[model samples]
Target: MDDAIRKAEILIEALGYIHAFRHRQVVIKLGGSAMEEPAALRSTLQSILFLAAVGLRPVLVHGGGKPIDRAMTAANLPTKKVLGRRYTDEATLAIVAKVLREDINDSIVRQMRELGGRAVSLHTGSTQALFGERLKLKGPDGELVDLGNVGEVNKIDGDLISSFTDAGLIPVLPCLAYDAHGNWLNVNADTAAAAVAGFLKAAKLILLTDTPGILRDRQDPKTLISSLNEAESRKLIAEGIIDSGMIPKVEACFDCLRSGVEQTHVIDGRLRYSLLLEIFTKSGIGTEIRL
Candidate 1:
């Protein structure tokens, strides 16, 4: 069939990309609208399997923040978010850690295995006391308060990630971490992914977010800027063009680029094979930020 031939061609192209990037480490932050949509979730799982089958080294760091919020609400716990990071108090942190480490993490491992990919899920505290700083935020009502357990990633162990990757197991890292004194802290998944990418000197940091990429004009889809550097991103932030949920995403991209990650990409994971399109095609589906 002609369709079969077309499919074969596509697969061959994908194989070429894999052969080219073989043994190169790629850290993927799989989250945002992609995780929220049923179709997107299936596509991402399949994409990972395809990448592994083709011999492209892939490491995944996923976000379950939205799921945790739903669980908290279902459990009748008071939930609050500061600067987009969940405020996990002593009580909430227990619930969060349980959901993140036990529920979401296990599900990812199970799904990846079902797809024939060797996936190993892990929590930050499993290896060591990776640290973060608690952030203060203004409440929804504009009240300034310190949100406990909601922190920004300050440190991570690259050795653990490398060991897992070197053994041919894809590391599916959860965003839950522990303080130096053994307190549980919740880190933003984007920041956590970028940290891991930096530590490993990964060749690529691919963020599977909702938006197609960074658009110069938020209202204009065609205004998507293909690439940016640290200084350019900071200037955009200073100009107030970059704010809201984009701040952390931009920060993560900048961090990865500064730390020698070859290229950082923010793509709309809603597409079935956006990762492949970005990797193999000339025109990609999202933004590519570099140093």
Candidate 2:
């Protein structure tokens, strides 16, 4: 009886959030260890399905770095990184496209269906919702460094994505976009998700990563910062607390916030139902960045 009562109380706690977020779009960027672990990925997908079932429009964007690496190895290609970003040559881009579209994207859609949720794949090989130009980086010496097939998201098909969400289907997009010349470009998943959120003017953008939000001490999970504003987030970045891979994620949040997204969250996707806890619970289990 006590266990049942506690479950009912949990539902009551979530009621307000459900009502508030109904029909509001929420963009989720899913990657990191969660994608590699069966249980974590299952739980995260279930949470997303729950959100859709309750009337919140959820769009999923994913990155498959580990699988891509494995595919590259099988094809005897060397994996390269420049400034913590993948340096995609033609060969690498081919492998990336195959792994992300044929393997990861299709698998996610299939899983969602198996789990009794409707999902559709939107990538270069399909609906091609994202479009961008090739990306170039600068070295410390101010020299233009070419990251061959890499690109940044320039535009998203808001109407098409909206159509899917409006019809009670989740659109699963792999972090690959098409250039104006009809070439496929490798885009950072975090940036792609942010662009989608910004274009749709989503209510919130949630990045599901491996870490337990942003921690003051990188080595300690207990030091997580539950909430911070844009200024504070920038300060943390300058202080070196938020460095490397985390910088892009934080910047993605900044982009979404600037585009009028109400809030952005970085949470540990490895935790079961972390998405639900972050969105529905009063004391969220992640770091929320607001303007």
Candidate 3:
């Protein structure tokens, strides 16, 4: 009876958030070690289900980094990573599309269905083409280097996403997009999510990652910063506290905030119910980025 009462109380506590975000759109970027571990993946997906069931329209942008690596290994292709971003060549791009669409995206949709939720995959080709542009990476000398087949979200298909959400369906977006010339391009999932959130003018952009949010010291859990703004984030980057791969993720959140997204959150997806804890409770679990 005590446990039942506690559960009821928790639901009541979540009532306010559920009502506040009702009918609003939220973009979720899900991946990393969170997808690799079965238990973490299940818990996180269930949280997403909960969000949808409660009336907030949720969209998912997912990554397949590990799966792409495995595909590259099978193809006997050399994997080159620069600044936490993959140097995607022609061969590697092919595998990225295959793994992202066929393996990771399809599997996630299947899993979402299994959990009693309706999910749809936004295929990477022209019919969907979540983003329509190519990406330019930085060179060793700080020059803009063009990484072949990599994209950085120039535009998004807002209507397509809205069309699905309007029908009470969750849209599972692939990180890959189309270039100006009608070619497929690989995009980082974080960048993809930020762009989507900005286009949707979403209420929030939630990133489900492996870490315990952003820490003042990467090595120390006790150094976690629960909230941050764009200026503070820039200062951290200038100080090298936020560099390499983390730079892009942080920049993406900042960009989202600047583009009118209300808030962006980076949370530890490994902890069960972390999504609910961050949204429904007074104190969120991760570092929330705002203006």
Candidate 4:
């Protein structure tokens, strides 16, 4: 009886949140070790389906870096990184496309269906919801550095995405987009999810990663920052507290905030039901960046 009462209390705690978020969109970016573990991935998908079941629309954008790397190795292609971003040449781009579209995206959609959720793949082969142009970068010497086949998102097909959500279906997208010249480009999944959130004016943007949000001490999990503002986040970046892969994730949050999204969160995806806890609980288990 005690355990049953506890379960009822949990539902009562979440009731207000469920009502508030009903019919509102939430964009989730899935990556890191969360995707590598089968059990964790299924748990995360179940949480997403729970969100959908309660009437909140959810959109998922995924990254397949580990899988892509393995695929490239099998193809005998040398993987290159330029300034923390993948330098995708023709061969590398082909493998990336294949892995993202055929493997990762399909697997996610199929798994969601098996979990009793309605999901549709929105990629270059499908509705092609995301579009962008080639991305160019610069080296330390201020000279142009070519990152072939990599691109940044510029436009999103919000209407098409809305159509899917309206029909009570979740839209799953890969980190691949088409350019105006009909070329496929590799995009960073974090930024891709942020762009989608911005275009849809989503109520929340959640990035599920390996770490326990942003910490003052990288080695200490207890030092996690529960809430952050834009100015403080930039100060931390300038102070070198936020660096490397985390920099892009923080910047993605800033982009979502600037575009009028209410809040953005970075949480530990490896934790079971972290998604539900972050959204439904009063004391969320992640760092929330708000304007």
Q: Give the clash count for each candidate.
A: 0, 0, 0, 0
* lDDT, candidate 4, 1-291, per-residue tens: 999999999999999999999999999999988899998899999999999999999999999999999999998888899988999988899999999999999999999999999999998645999999888888899988889999999999999999999899999999999999878999999999999999999999999999989999999999999999888989999999888999999989989889988889999999999999999999999999886
Off by over 4 Å in 3: 124-129, 140-142
- Clash count (model 2, backbone only): 0
Worst 10 residues of 2 by lDDT: 119-128
- Give each model's whole-structure lDDT: 0.80, 0.94, 0.88, 0.94
92 in model 2: Cα distance from truth in Å? 0.1
Q: How far is candidate 4 from the true structure (C-alpha RMSD, Å)?
A: 1.0
- Model 1 over residues 1-291: C-alpha lDDT tens digits? 999999888778767667777787898887777877878887888887677666667888888777887888899997776565666788898887887778877887897888778988767546542466776677779987887877767777777777777778888877866666777787888888888888778888999987788888888989988888878888888888777878888888878878888888988889888888898766778888876
TM-score of 4: 0.98
Per-residue lDDT tens digits of candidate 2, residues 15-89? 999999999999999998989999999999999999999999999999999999999999999999997889999
Query: How far is 177's C-alpha from truth in model 3 (Å)?
Result: 0.3
| Model 1 lDDT, full chain set | 0.80
TM-score, each model? 0.87, 0.98, 0.95, 0.98
Q: Which pairs clash (backbone N, Cα, C closer than 3 Å) in model 3?
A: none
Candidate 1 residue pairs that clash: none
